[model samples]
Target chain A: MTKLLLKKLTKTFERRVIFKDINLEWNGPGLFGIAGPNGSGKSTLVKVVTGLISATAGEITIETDGKKLSPSTAIDYIGFASPYLTLYDEFTAKENLEFAVNIRGQQLDEAKMDQLLEHFSLLKRKNDFVKAYSSGMKQRLKIIFAFIHNPDMIILDEPTANLDAEGKQKVYDLVKQTAKEKMVIFATNEEEELAMCDEIIKILSYQPAGRN
Target chain B: MFRRALWLFNKDLTSELRTRYAINALAMFIIVTISVIMFAIGQETISAALAGGLLWVVIFFSAMSGLSRAFVSEEERGTSLLLQLVASPTVVLTGKLFYNLILVFAMNMVILVLYSALFDAFVLKNVYIFFFSFVLGNTGLAFASTIIASIIAKANSKGTLYPVLSFPILLPLLLMLVEITKRCSEGVKFEDIAPEFFALVSYNVVIAAVSYMLFDFIWKE
Candidate 1:
């Protein structure tokens, strides 16, 4: 179905080329991983894919029901999460989820939200402000908020960075379960996490010999 | 669109309710600044002539501190990216502007009371003109604050950069506000200040439209 496609994408910062003539595609439901070392533009690639930043030169297209979607319209179908992103600390988990739904013009069903909370083992802390929750709990809440609207494509950057063993398993299970209907793309350097991916793309940096 | 605005407004309101730091700082600053002004003009028979300019200076600096923190708080907590991903930039900016307008409006009222108490300023006989000046002035402040905050949100020294960037663009609005305020404080009729008031309104409208159009681009980074 080619949910997303990027053609000849290029980006530069302060006259330094990040990537040139980059092309990628996501055709269907599966887990895709982008692996690279620090400063390799993995995060920049994700940002361009999400349309958070425009490529210096390229076209990004999204397909839904055999129709091409514009960048602004495509945002509704994309759910994104990153380690640097956080939910409102003053908001309870439920309130945070409600806000996400409200912005998307959807009503929050109490029973459904409760089920999601229970799935993440956050039902007991549903009313607690996110600031009071542990880091792992906040991460779980972010995931729940991202998926609450049932987005067709989910992009996660360093999704498992701060999780313990149990938290990691829960996210892994969620990713696998979500892959049944939506494409999941994760960017990370951890080999263990790469084991769950259906495809892995490694990004390499170009270095001049003897320049180091 | 309005629902998204409401969500952001509620989010900020809840946060402010929990902290109360912006309001407390602004209120105390206003009180101290006004007290100093009173001492400087002691027994000089403070004229309604100077009341409008004095009141706005108090509100402007107070808003400078309070409104600049609006988006910085989001960035500090790392929630801004989440907000950008979930809501349209127009909605986000509108929500923040609306919240700041309410905060500044409250501060304006408090300043009015404190100005009267400290300097024995007379009651504003031209109530409509006074209200008009306050709304116009606050709109300009909110517009400038939101745009400047977006620019400096990525900078390392946002606290100092905010006012430096905003003051230049806001100068015209400040001048218009002072003229309208000066006329109203002198118990002049609304017709007498209509030209200045209209100019102030036009200034606010133009800036608000421009800022709204450019906000999505500015917030993209």
Candidate 2:
């Protein structure tokens, strides 16, 4: 079980407000969505929540299994997958996964690796260089990389960005399966994707009251 | 963290072998610079001090060419985010630092052999001082270069920013290296260069400690 609470969250870029005064309490073991139109601080909010970027003024308290986590170790419990993140193309998918697993000081578990590779339909091509994989395949590999460590919270920004209908279905199914045990923050505006969420948080673009 | 750093080192070694990006740049730079030096010094006898100075020039420039590749590759390939997500800042910095250390040590040893082979004045009567300076110099070079490389990787003009940042930061260390090299090649005894050895070790420690403290912010931000 994981809990995230954001208090008075405000983000500004060079005096230009992106979002402000956003307070939310999010709990997981269920699917949640952060829905916003394009350029409405969706990715920024996602990045902030994941501690990839700092909030301008707010507090993000992340508690997993009833223990409060500091910033340094918060990421240890987070599995982040996004288009903004990429795998090493110079490496084969297997080596890339191995590096990812090993870099966290955890040895790669062959059985879990096989299960994830098969889940993403990447088992057959695990030995192939990621450069040779299609974008959809690359996206699948990213998903496997994220889940390999069995993180407490899984955050996916624009999760279905490059997927075909079949790939999208696979993701929806995976999310369904994952949400049964792990917290999934699905950041997207797609109606179909949002509909699967147990709750949706809207982020509207910020405009000052006096501005036209 | 140590094991993870080793994994990263191996990953980098594999990538470097396949791409040869830094290796080619370093090789070409060394060959061209040495050739130019050979031409410039033709028919004129130079002191070992001057030879030592020239050798360090090659080292500094070679590092400028190759060392930044460690962090810059992560940025260029868009794998920086993945790395950020997977590892702690300490892990990332330690791992990259190890890779850079290996590169600096290997490149300088190659430069040392090549420089020794090409110059008649490059004598080493005090092998002990040369040994101490060589090891310490390479360590300091890698430490300072690793931090600066991470900085320049974030800059808009990466190519120009590296040397512009490295030159001033490395000036003190480079001066000590040249001085020790000159003394070593001139057959000065090892005991006389104690102060140089101390400075070199301190330089490496200070850079390593400061870089460790600051990398978290540089990396996360």
Candidate 3:
């Protein structure tokens, strides 16, 4: 079943058209990459899909358990991460994870949080304030917080933007692993990241064509 | 929903407990402001009227400083996005507002104590009236700060904008707060101050609802 579907998605900023009539869909349990250059509305596209921003004109529907979810109701199954968004710096990794779990109305799974910390190679720094973390460390923590609840669809924008070789590999592995059970929408410009995608969609620049 | 607010409250409390920057800055600002006021007034009558105004002036300025930093730690570490994505905007605002209320409330208590001590004033003749005034004042402070913080979050010169945007909107509430506090300080009965108290309460409710509805719009931007 299609987990998320966007039809005729259009967004404008300050009377300038960023993108229009954009159509996209995602079914579960696969890797989908949105490949584009800078200024291609990639991040905006992700934001619209996650309902972070409203579209100027279009419809977004999320299908789960044979039911179509509205925007407010659709949030429960979507986990989103971007460099532009991050966790609280004053909070320890453990505290941040616990807060995320709390918002989901679920009990804190200390064991799972610890495992994620270890998986991200942040176990040693789990107790430190995020302000004290490196850029790469902060990015990893953001991803961890997104996945802590095991949402059915994970939307990540430029997931490897600030990482070193080891950090990049860890994220690649994490995305690959997550794709086994949840639909993963990864938006990036790096060819290396795109090489791992099961399917790729290139966002084309605007061209004046005959009206339908 | 309350649980989510509590979670945010505890998270903020624990973090502030660890660093102590927000509370410490607010306390120092309050103390220094109070000391300056005492020196300026020099032992003159220091009317109950002026004392109440001074008390809120100290809180309002100190709270702007404290509340601006409330989101700094989150934004600096990129955790604010995590916060936004994990919970709905309403939930995020609720959590943030709740945490900020605690910070502002604590600061109010400290300011009240110090103001009473320095002014040689005994304002607690009716504990219930005093408590009601404090709650209304704190609610107004928290609600206004929450909306202003979101506005300042994205601005480059937030330092200048925070007070400029917040104070104008908050002036009426501040006036009401000081009026009720002054009346209570003079042993005025609850009924005497009821109208002002209700006005402050309504201000708080209206601002809270408006901010809550508008938060999603601001958060997305």
TM-score of each: 0.93, 0.98, 0.89
Native-referenced DockQ of model 3: 0.59
- lDDT for model 3: 0.81
What lDDT score goes with residue A84 in model 3? Answer: 86
Clashes by residue pair, model 3: A86-B78, A86-B79, A86-B81, A86-B82, A87-B78, A87-B79, A88-B79
- Docking quality tier of model 1: medium
- Summed backbone clashes in each candidate are 0, 0, 7
User: Candidate 3 lDDT, tens digit per residue, A157-204?
Assistant: 999878889988988888899898888888999998888888887876
Model 2: per-residue Cα lDDT over B58-112, one tens digit each: 9999999999999999999888888888778888888888888889988988888
- Show the colliding residue pairs in model 1: none
lDDT for position A108 in model 2: 89
Could you give candidate 1's per-residue lDDT for residues B1-221 as a string of tens digits? 88778888887887898878677778788878888887888888766767768877877777777777678888877777787787778888888888888887788888877777776665577778778677778777778877787778888998788778878888888888887777776788877777887888888888888988888788887
Task: Give the range of the ten consecutive residues with the poorest summed lDDT in model 3 chain B.
Answer: B75-84
In model 3, the Cα lDDT at residue B26 comes to 83
Candidate 2: tens digits of C-alpha lDDT, residues A1-212: 99989999999988899999999998888999999989999899989988888999989998999999887787778888888788988899999988877887778898999988887789999999999999999988888887888888999998787889988888899889999988899889899989999988999999989988
lDDT of 3 by residue, B127-158 (tens): 78878778888988888888888878777788
Q: Please give the range of 10 consecutive residues that has the lowest summed lDDT in model 1 chain A.
A: A203-212
Model 3 residue A1 CA deviation (Å) reads 5.0
